[model samples]
Target: MFEGVDLEVPAGGLLVAHGPAGCGRTSLLLALAGRMRLSGGAIRVGGYVLPAAGRRVRATVAVARAAPAVALEGRLRVKEVMAERRLTGAGVTERRIREAFETVGIAPRGSDLVEDLGPLQALLLATALALAERPGALVVDDVDEGLPPDAHGSVWQALDRVRNSGPGPTVLAGCVRTPPPASGLVALSLPRRSLDRLPAETAAAREDTAT
Candidate 1:
């Protein structure tokens, strides 16, 4: 549950939701992506209001979960992932896929199996998939996890490119610490709260501040 949470991300701005482990960062991301139930308040993406009854927000928003435990069919090759997404109605083209891989600095080959890549590569591939959807807003949890400190800048630079590419997508990423310089990222910190106890007024105040 998130309390006192208020934030506004400008179109195409990179917003980082920074906090410690178990802080409501992931939950907040899930809520914004319309994957979790919110007991109160509003979530708006572009001009559409989320959590409205029967309103589908997933079509315009994309989320890449922290740790990105996405199950890839081990038999599928890297190119197949892009191909399958296109076949399934995602607007990804071969060129776009190639470009996304290049943006993330990955050399995606047709013969490379998903399971053969290390964790960082897998995360980058997942990000590429999300980009292929051409969402108006992108939510990524733990943008820097599992990556060596030296590699953070390159990864953030790629994300910066994605953000600046057009009226592109608004990015909301969660992290445990301050992000690197290239993220062009601003932050909103979620407060620590006890799950067993409800502090309604306190949460409300934080939300007030966030807005």
Candidate 2:
């Protein structure tokens, strides 16, 4: 719940939504990504209006939530996920998958099962999978959750590379506190309130980024 919330996010910039637990950070991210609907106001991304009919907004925006389950079948190998994504027309190539893994500093080992990877490795793999799509925008929630503090910097570096890559993408990260340093980063604070009063300009700005 965010009331009369207004924000300005520049193109190719990183926006960190910071607040305490249950303060609607994730909700705001989901709403902006079109995974959730707001009771009032509007959301647009990269000029594509959200909650629109037959819109391919999901393809343009990649979202990784906090403690997101990898949904890896026990029988599937690490490489199989990439294969499945390609078979399903996700356009994920072996080279792209390899590059994504390398981007996160993970070595490609096709023999490894998803269940065997440690927590940090699993998180990196998930991010690689998302990056393989080369989406125009990324919405990550609680990036630091469930990880040792030392690993946070590496993850932040990876995300920064994603944000600074060619043409790049607008990134909106949700968290219970401040995010690590990154170039061109902005912070937005959300306080609990009725969602109906959210600012139209801010919603439109979000839509522009999504587009």
Candidate 3:
């Protein structure tokens, strides 16, 4: 439950929603992706109004949730996921999917079951699926989950590259800690609100570096 939470993710830019637990970081991401409903507050995605135009917003936004909570249906295959993305997404080609898979570094045979991969690989697979959509906007929750500290840099670097790519998707990613130093990455820190005061309100401090 959060109120007075405002955010601005520039077109084709990267915004890192960084905060500790219980700070409504997950909620914010869910709300933006139209996965969660809000009681009040106007939200517009890619110029379309929210809740009313939620379907359009959803079409434009792709989400990759935390690995533990977001399971691939038992024995689901990698190629099948990419195939689904191609069917649902615009201008998606098999080569594009392969490129995304390569970028994520998960090259297990497409015949392999989702259960076969390790946690990190599964996360990467999910991420690759999202990237395959080439959506107008993408939201990835718990970007640093189940990843090594050193690998965290690679994740941020990848996201930054995605954001800076030519007319690529605008990205909003959630992380419990800071990401690697990079320009054009806006880090929005959700301030911890005391339960006694403003128990239902949430606020974010901008660490904008949009140059």
Clashes of 2: 9
Model 3 pairs whose backbones collide:
none
TM values, all candidates? 0.81, 0.81, 0.79
lDDT of each: 0.66, 0.68, 0.68
Q: List candidate 1 stretches off by more than 4 Å.
A: 53-55, 66-76, 181-184, 195-211
lDDT of 1 at 121: 80
lDDT of 2 by residue, 5-35 (tens): 5666666788888887767777777766666
TM-score of 2: 0.81
Candidate 3 similarity to native, TM-score? 0.79
How well does candidate 3 score on lDDT at residue 192? Answer: 65
User: Which structure is stronger by TM-score: 1 or 3?
Assistant: 1
Rank list by lDDT: 3, 2, 1
Q: Which stretches of candidate 3 lie over 4 Å from their true place?
A: 66-71, 88-91, 191-211
lDDT by residue (tens digit), candidate 3, 29-48: 77677666767665767666
